[model samples]
Target: MTLAAGSLCLGGIVLFVVLAAGALLAFDEPGTANDGATFDAYVWRVARFTLLQASLSTALSIIFAIPVTRALARQLSFPGRVWVLRLMALPLGLPALVAALGLIGIWGRQGVLNSGLAWLGLAQPVSIYGLSGILIAHVFFNMPLAARLMLGGLERIPGEYWLVGTNLGMRPWSIFRFIEWPAICGLLPGIAGLIFMLCATSFTLVLTLGGGPAASTIEVAIYQALRFDFDPPRAIALSMLQITVTAVLLISIRMLTPKADEGHGSGRMVRRFDGRRGLGRAGDGLVIAIAVVFLVLPLASVVSSGLRSDLTKLVTDPLVQRAFLTSLVIAVVSGLFCVVATAAMIQARQTALASRHPTKPLRGLASGISASTSLVLLVPPVVLGAGWFLLLRPFGDVALFAPLLVILINMLMAMPFVYRVLEPAIATHSARTGRLAASLGLGGWNRLRFIDWPGLRKPFMMALSFACALSLGDLGAVALFGSQDMVTLPWLLYSRMGSYRSTDAAGLALFLGLICLMLTIAGTPAADRNDKRKPDAA
Candidate 1:
């Protein structure tokens, strides 16, 4: 029964993608021209720009992260070290639109940077727009993630290696070359690929900061084709191009980066001699300080600018009220859907794993069901939205079904995350209690309430809250489907930015950021605590 349900959920995702792709293909030929630009030429330009930015963003993020990760790994006992690591996780939950606004407040024409430059009598002020701005925003969001992941790789290093290196009187560079470099290198391919995929499919950051056509990504181009130009053929072409690029990236990531065993280390600190004094210590401290400032300044700008806005008036506006409610409803509904689907998949996989004589096909089925959830990540939200737009347009007004499509896409997008959060808890619960529950003749709700729920409640809530936060901040699907009647907070915030309502946008950004932060805090405590308890072997 659980397998059937999981299969149904997977089937739904497949059906949606198939219908959308079929609709896109049915509507237009590939080489058709739109707005005097041949579809082929336009696609080539957009695809090239997309890959270029993604590659650059990945390179910059990884390059910046190496030093930060190394610094954190070396300086384990520094003041507020735990909080600094926690700070690195904050950007993951921060909405792209909110982060974009924060970046603008710091880097825009009348921003702090320009003001400072003027005070310093500098002739030229930096512009946070176009390729430069996209790279900055991507790096801001991705660098910390890379650092944290790389730090995990560093932490996984055994204590004996460090001991041997120290006994050999290895210099910093020598230790890095023989020890730290290999650990970091093993992680780089996977981290870089993940960052590249994110930047390639990035929609909100590019839409907000991509300046013009000269810097547009394929995802943004799809939005423009549908929303601005009303060119379905062009949107279809771009969507296909986006999918192709994503598939290639996914294939490359899989081929280049073999999976590593999940590490479970004893929680014990390993003493290290490197970077304990002299210029090495100072250099590590400097790197950490700069990273902290780079991260904190944008958030500070958001809060300061937001508090200065007319919040009472903005909150009172009916449009704002409606959008807020709409966003909450969508987020909650999507999160619930994700929870149900993820639970089914987890149950099926665990049941298969617990089988006494599992067949090859059964094992394959379980693996496939588990992998299917992540399949959504390969399809950009805009592509899904565009395909659905084509699929629904002929029936009636697409806007009428916008809310449903948005909810579905957001749910699918959140499923992988929800699954990751809930799977371990559920598996551990089953391992500990499954036999006892079976012997007691417990089944269904009785077993769940008596055994599973007690242990799984926190994890379940964490998954739900994280899923909700993700959906709440999503701008990609809504950008394609949003209308006067179907407005979401992200869509509303983007509209405000477009209209030059910086004060209102700032206020909205603050509200969204705070809500996301709360959800993230609730959802991440377990993982944060777990990380804090990790064995540091630097």
Candidate 2:
């Protein structure tokens, strides 16, 4: 049963791509390619912009993250520090539309900064549109992630390193050169590669702030081809291009990133002797403060601006109500599907490993199942949506299948994250209990209920909540399928923003942020509970 379920999940992804490719092959006109129209210009322009923006975004995010991570590394015990670290996770799950709105609240034409400049008679010198806007939004979302990953690497360094550095009377730069820099250097390729992949495939932020053709990425171009231009050939070509580019990047990342078997450090807290002098502490403070303001101010502005909105009107608004319901149903269904599918895949792998006959074939099948869960990462949502859209257009009304497509797409999209969270726990559990289960003659439902469920419940719940939050915040497929009848919150928020309903958008942004936050928070205590239990077990 587990193997069957896992096969179905893997088959679903393959089916979508196969159907999409079939649609393109069936529908694409040979003459269109020979005619040399938008395809040529779009290929060069969109590809160029996509690479340029993703590269710049990755570089900027990592550059800004280094100083902040260093600062936080040095000043580990400041008041409210832990909360600030928690807040850093916010941008990861925060809806793109919410972040975009929050950004606009502070950086828009008549935003706080502009108004302040006007008061100073200093003609507002900033514009949060075009390439600049895309970069800012990308940085807002990615810098914290980069910082945390780097900080984790820094913290993993042994305390003896700090002692030796101080014994040598090494300056801050010298210490970093010998110790911190080497650690960060090893991590940079992976971190930067992940950031680049994210930015390269970015859809919502680029669409919202792209402003015009000058800043459009390939993902946005694909959307425009299908939605606005209604050109299937162009859309298919762009989708293919996007997939190719993503595949190349994924391959490159696999090659570039170092394996994670470097060092298992002595698990003890390091006493910091460097970066504690007056000027060094002051510098660290400034860096930390800047990072805080950069990360926090936009969120604060969203809340402050949202407060002025009338809640009664927002709740009563027909579009908001419909979109909220649609979003809730999608999130809930997708969350459940993601968790079950992931469990099935993990179970199948465990069963294969336990197989007494034809172990090689069973293990190979299990490996394939494991790989399929991550297959979603290689295909951008826009491309997947476009592929399915092209496939369905011939059958009839695409709107009828919008909800179903969104749910399936969201499920596949969340699988990687879900797998990452659950795989470890499941592996550890199997290692600990596989023999015991076999000796007891436990298998299938009985084994799962008697062993796996109790052991894996916490991580499963946490992964589910997180997957739900991710799906809740997604705008990819909804953007492709949005219409009068089918509306999700991110789509609705985008609509309001596009229609110049700033106040309404801000109010909706607040609501969306709250819901996503609650989903995230619901899972937090589970992690804490699991952590507390770990020490006792150890």
What lDDT is obtained when candidate 2 is compared to the true structure? 0.85
For residue 147, model 1's alpha carbon misses the true position, in angstroms, by 0.2
Candidate 1 lDDT tens digits, 1-538: 8778877876787788778878877886455545535367767888899989999999999999999998998887877888898889889989999999999888888889989999999979889999999999999999999999999988878777777788999999998898898888888889999999999999999999999999999999999988898888788778877888888988988898967743344544567889999999999999999999999999999999999999999889999999999999999999999898889878987777677989997798788877777777778789889989888877899999999999999998888888888888888888888889989999988987888888889889889999999999999889988999998899999999999998999999999999999887786545444455533321
Cα lDDT, model 1, residue 58: 96
Poorly placed runs, candidate 2 (over 4 Å): 29-38, 261-268, 355-360, 526-538
lDDT of 2 by residue, 224-325 (tens): 988998877777777778888888888888899887644555755578977777999899999988988988889998898788888789999887898999
Query: Would you list the clashing residue pairs of candidate 2?
Result: none
What is the lDDT for 514 in model 2? 94
Q: What lDDT is reached at residue 245 by model 1?
A: 84
- TM-score of every candidate relative to the true structure: 0.95, 0.94
Mark the regions of model 1 whose C-alpha exceeds 4 Å error after superposition.
Answer: 28-38, 259-269, 526-538
The stretch of ten residues in a row with the least summed lDDT in candidate 2 is 529-538
